[model samples]
Target: MALKDEKVTLAHGGGGKAMRDLIEEVFTSVFRPDGMEDQARLQAAALADPGARLAFTTDGFVVDPLEFPGGDIGTLAVCGTVNDLAVGGARPLWLSAGFIIEEGLDLALLRRVVASMAAEAEKAGVRIVTGDTKVVGRGMADKLFITTSGIGVIPPGRDLQAANIRPGDVAIVNGVLGDHGAAIMAARGEMALSAEIASDCQGLGHLMEAVLAVAPGLRAARDATRGGVAAVLNEMAAAAGVAIEIDEAALPLRAEVRGLCEILGLDPLYLANEGTLVLFVPEHEVAAALAAMRATEAGQGAVAIGRVVPGEAGRVSMRSAFGGLRIVDMLVGEQLPRIC
Candidate 1:
């Protein structure tokens, strides 16, 4: 007659009275006033824009395997949504989740995913105050899918957008590349390499703080996830009507991830990165951005990768260390199709 702890039934996800009861019994129980004050208030608070002007974005997670080395779908969902706001130069604030679970899914696994999501939200300084869930037949869906909507506030006197890009502006990545894609491939047993390539999945809240602290005026920013750095640059350049020139030697790639990509005939430049950022800023602000970025954990391998040029605004070109040059075209379709 009642749902038990560690066991979730269909009633938990239903829109009926049972769902409301579950929300009060468990969700509220974790974030009452007795807990961490700020986090507690966040957990129990309703959706309200913290800033006069807000930037909102939503993202969905359906990474194959759902669980990976550095993170799971839960954390990925939170990180992806928040990163969207952060790279847009906004201070991420709130998140709303919508879950769709396959029938016959393990109750324990679902709980694990939510727990991880809660922990991630706490770390990112965002709250998951509103959400809905549904169940479908086992074969009709993946084990579980999470969709998150994020809201954030942009700081004052600091205007950042794709249109702000200009020729001579430099591009810099917060850290290493291809870790997330490589990690997922390794998890799926897609390649055999001597080294381990765990996903670079992580939160960039602190990293964002560091960059803005020094280079407060940024032109534009984008977190290189599905399309990697190359595609992201192309998007920004095209949107801003500028050509992007990146130094192949400057794009930081971890040896382990690179080795795996090489062995598998994959280009590291096109691989996804969950915890990296591609920033385009004025040439004068480049050093400051680099300094600020390297100040955070997520930006340990920060490097100045490229610059904007006048022609072929939407095209990306890579310059070899030895002086050769080649065009870096966007992927026809998704490289790692299901990568979050």
Candidate 2:
């Protein structure tokens, strides 16, 4: 029962004294210096925010290893949920975290994750308003898993959706593709290879604001997470009933990432990305959108890679570097699971 020998146990989730002690000594100690409460309360005026619409999103993180090159699971939780709201033209404000910790897990590891989450929230200017914790048997779950839900304010007349995509709309990526996936894969150490790669995990709320400020007519925006840009484009093409054509040579892929994908027989376009985003902007606004994206740290490498066209609805094609056309289909199965 002492801190020195402490490890997560079912009693820590029993809603009893053990639960209180665990939460107080660990989560609250990092997440809230003030105190812990059953629920987080905010002023009505704070939520109103000039009558802006609310964007709500929730995501789960079960990434293996829990930590990777550029970030850890804690940072991923905050960035992933915040990016969800950002892509919808929202300014993220608050988040709720839930942890499913496995018995026998090291308390120190849990503290490290909690600390990372707290730090990332501060950087993104969001609050960890409320949270819950549960402990399962050692074999019932992985070492730890986190679920984060967030809410944000969307300005008036800033609606964004894939259905708004039209012919001539351009597809743009914020940065190099597949860094997150490649980093995670390399971290796993299963391939017995080495490459200098890091997960491209970071908040995009500021980048979205900059682009929206200049190109309010942006049709759609999405973080290239689980399925990467290929999935995003396929979904958007289907939603907008248009075909998407991308130039293979235009994709900004890192040499390390490309090499990793090549050795593993994976397509960088299909690999996951944590910080990258895909934006669809009208032809007239493409230049301004790129300019706005390049102005922000998160979007400095932004480039227009493709365009929408009239064809079979829901089709995504790429012009191969070898001068042939190929379909970029939705991944039949996960290429790298638990990369996020």
Candidate 3:
């Protein structure tokens, strides 16, 4: 191994032998890109299709604690960018990762994060084609921060968008919500809480592919990330000029997450999620969509939670278990910071 030091130093970012060693041993070796070029030379058959379109998305991961229950910053970075493209009905193909490491941080930890990114990219059927690494003073950054940009191909005839949603469209979610947020909170230990909840951090590219395969008329999908499912529902309703009504009894939530929210006087609807996604399909294809999603590992808990209705435009409401209706408005402020 060329990297003899146990911890990173400023020399690693000086574009010297130390930098080369760090890049070779820690990142490039695991990712194995085509070359060490300043940019990736890319080619794909999907791009050659006449009406196919390109999809690109970038995201930065600064989740506190660096490592959490179910995933770490690396897992979050790759999956986050991949899901961003997947929700658009794109087949994620490539990713570019950039790392900012704090001086004096353990090299072993960095290696582990890089390895996790490699494993996740492979599982999602994407390649980490290019990346950059930099080291900052100890106090200049957290242990590490990662930014990822992804590229994918949206096949011809696939025009999924929130604006395509309409009344009678069925709303479905892949799995339980609020687990990621609750897991982060418990990991922080500031609240003096304890729970066995694991962050629901996983890639959804395969799940989306499966759903689209059976339900070709899938209207739209949104990964419920920062603002959980409520934010996504509101966005879809606003884009489609429609109303969304969800059944409270039909929502999928873990008991621990529900308990945590109730204890903290928080609404689980606003909690963040990493792998969860909300999708809308026409009434006729709802069963097929649900079956297709449930058949996938990432969406085994898929279920119908709501439906679009003819009512006030941009309105979202929840039919409580008590059978009363109340508006589920857009999140007003941050529910959990640095959550993903």
- Residue-pair clashes per prediction, in order, are 1, 0, 0
> Candidate 3: lDDT of 196?
86
Task: Estimate every model's Cα lDDT from 0 to 1.
Answer: 0.79, 0.89, 0.95
Number of the top-ranking candidate, with TM-score as the measure:
3
TM-score of 2: 0.95
Q: Model 2, 1-340: lDDT tens per residue?
A: 3344357878888988888888887887777733555788754354556667888999999998798899999999999999999999988989999999999888878888899999999988888888999899978998999999999888877879999998999999999999999999999999897897989999999999899888989998999998888998898898989999999999999999988888889999988999999999998998998998898889999999999977889999999999999999998989998876
TM-scores of the candidates in the order shown: 0.88, 0.95, 0.99
Per-residue lDDT of candidate 3, residues 49-132 (tens digit)? 999999999999999878899999999999999999999999999999999999998999998899999999999999999999
Considering every candidate listed, which one attains the maximal lDDT?
3
Displacement of residue 227 (Cα, Å) in model 1 is: 1.3
lDDT of 1 by residue, 28-121 (tens): 5432224423322342232342434577999889998788889889889989998999888778888877888776677667767777888988
**Where does candidate 1 have its weakest 10-residue lDDT segment?**
36-45
Candidate 2's C-alpha lDDT?
A: 0.89
